[model samples]
Target: MKRLAVSLTLFLVLSLGVGLLVSGSEVLDWGIAGGLFAIAVLGECFRFWIRRTRSKKRDSSSV
Candidate 1:
């Protein structure tokens, strides 16, 4: 989880930096940044859901 968060953050920063350098447009940069942010949030939500389901399975099996 920690690693995932770190990697996602790094990717966002790197992407934004590259986008800014290539486009030099704040409006486009914000658009790209918003898309990336949405993707990151979705990824985290998916990860959390997977972990929750796995833990529930483990708990049921143990009982």
Candidate 2:
């Protein structure tokens, strides 16, 4: 439940940021949007890799 709420909040915030970038008519707007997108992607990748490594460790220790 907590994770769901957090995810929703992040989604809304990111959506707003992207919407602003789309509506605004400035180079800086695009830069901000691109930077935010890259940051989010990198964060998700990092979280995935960490979860993968931790699961591997848990599986090995159980044997």
Error of 1 at 1 (Å): 5.2
lDDT of 2 by residue, 1-63 (tens): 566457656865785578586766754465666667667657766877998999999889953
lDDT of 1: 0.76
Superposed on all Cα atoms, the candidates' RMSDs to the truth, in angstroms, are 2.8, 4.6
lDDT, candidate 1, 1-63, per-residue tens: 788779788878866875676566453566776677678778778988999999999889853
Clashes of each: 0, 0
Worst 10 residues of 2 by lDDT: 24-33
**Most accurate candidate by TM-score:** 1
Clashing pairs in 2: none
Candidate 2, residue 40: the lDDT equals 69
Cα miss at 62, model 1 (Å)?
A: 4.7
Give model 2's TM-score versus the native structure. Answer: 0.59
RMSD of 2: 4.6
